[model samples]
Target: MTTKKILIVDDEAAIVAVLEELLTEEGYTIIKAYNGLEAISIFNKKQHIDLMIVDYCMPHLNGRRVIETMRQNPRYSTTPVIVITGSEKQFSNFPEDSTYQFLIEKPFNLERITETVHKLLG
Candidate 1:
């Protein structure tokens, strides 16, 4: 089977590197973006992203805006999005639609992250 493609959008390079290593080991192709604007640029250029994992607090555009823009595009409207946020209270503002899933609080366990990705991609 072909490997799945996943986009990691976070302002921190360390977080992106860690996630890249973890997901790469699990046989998924990883794309790294340091901010929401870069993420959107990559998405527009690549056009084959299967999933997106975004940090809620990022400079320029922010995760919510990124997902909202993606949802507006017919090509990405059905794509799965997983938001990683440092605040649980922020999740309350997320869309009620099933297309978006979330991981609350920062510093998530690698195993849980992998599991959530599997569940979403499955």
Candidate 2:
């Protein structure tokens, strides 16, 4: 089977690095974006992204805006998104009908993240 491609958008370099290493070890290809604008640019160029993990507090556009923009495009309307944030209360501001089904709080365990990713990708 072909390896899945996952896009990770976050402003923290350490978070991106850790996710890249973890996901790569799991045999998935990862695309990293530092902010929402960069994430959108990557999405537009590499349109085959299989999954996306976004940080809610990113600069330039923020995660909700990124997801909303992608959802507006027919190509990504049904794509699965997992939102990670230090503040869970911020999730209430997301679109009422957004495609995201998972919210992972900050300081998450690696095992939990891996398990969630496997479940979502399946």
Candidate 3:
């Protein structure tokens, strides 16, 4: 019954705020990052992250690069990542052989993400 740590990365402050509140209430330890570069900084210091929920489009660095960066590190190599994006076309731009676990379309259902997190972390 150990607590799962979730890193939520998005440049949108409102989106980050809502997700942080939702996941916190679900009993997961939440780590907040405003963008991909910030997410990397956070990851460097907190190497034991259980899961990562990253938005695809952000300034400085994008979610795909952020996840790729994490995957290169031994500590987070197998950590599950859920990528959120608004455009399916843009999603297709990511590498076909990438290590990310899920690609969720933007304006996603809260329950869907919650269920996904539970399924992955359980």
Which candidate ranks first by lDDT, i.e. highest?
3
On the 0 to 100 scale, the lDDT of residue 94 in model 2 is: 64
In model 3, the runs with Cα more than 4 Å from the true position are 90-97
TM-score of 1: 0.89
Order the candidate numbers by TM-score, best to worst.
2, 3, 1
Tally clashes: model 1: 0
Query: Please, what are the lDDT tens digits per residue for candidate 1 over residues 30-74?
Result: 988899899889767746888999888877787778888788788
Q: What is candidate 1's CA lDDT for residue 19?
A: 93
Q: Estimate each model's TM-score.
A: 0.89, 0.92, 0.91
Superposing every Cα of model 3 onto the true structure, what RMSD results?
Answer: 1.6
Off by over 4 Å in 1: 91-99
Q: Write the per-residue lDDT of candidate 3 for residues 31-56, one digit (tens) a residue.
A: 98999888889778855799999988
Tens digit per residue, CA lDDT, model 2, 8-115: 999999999999999999999998889999988876774688889998887679888999887877777777888888975536666444468688889878888889
lDDT winner, 1 or 2: 2
**Native-referenced Cα lDDT, model 1:** 0.83
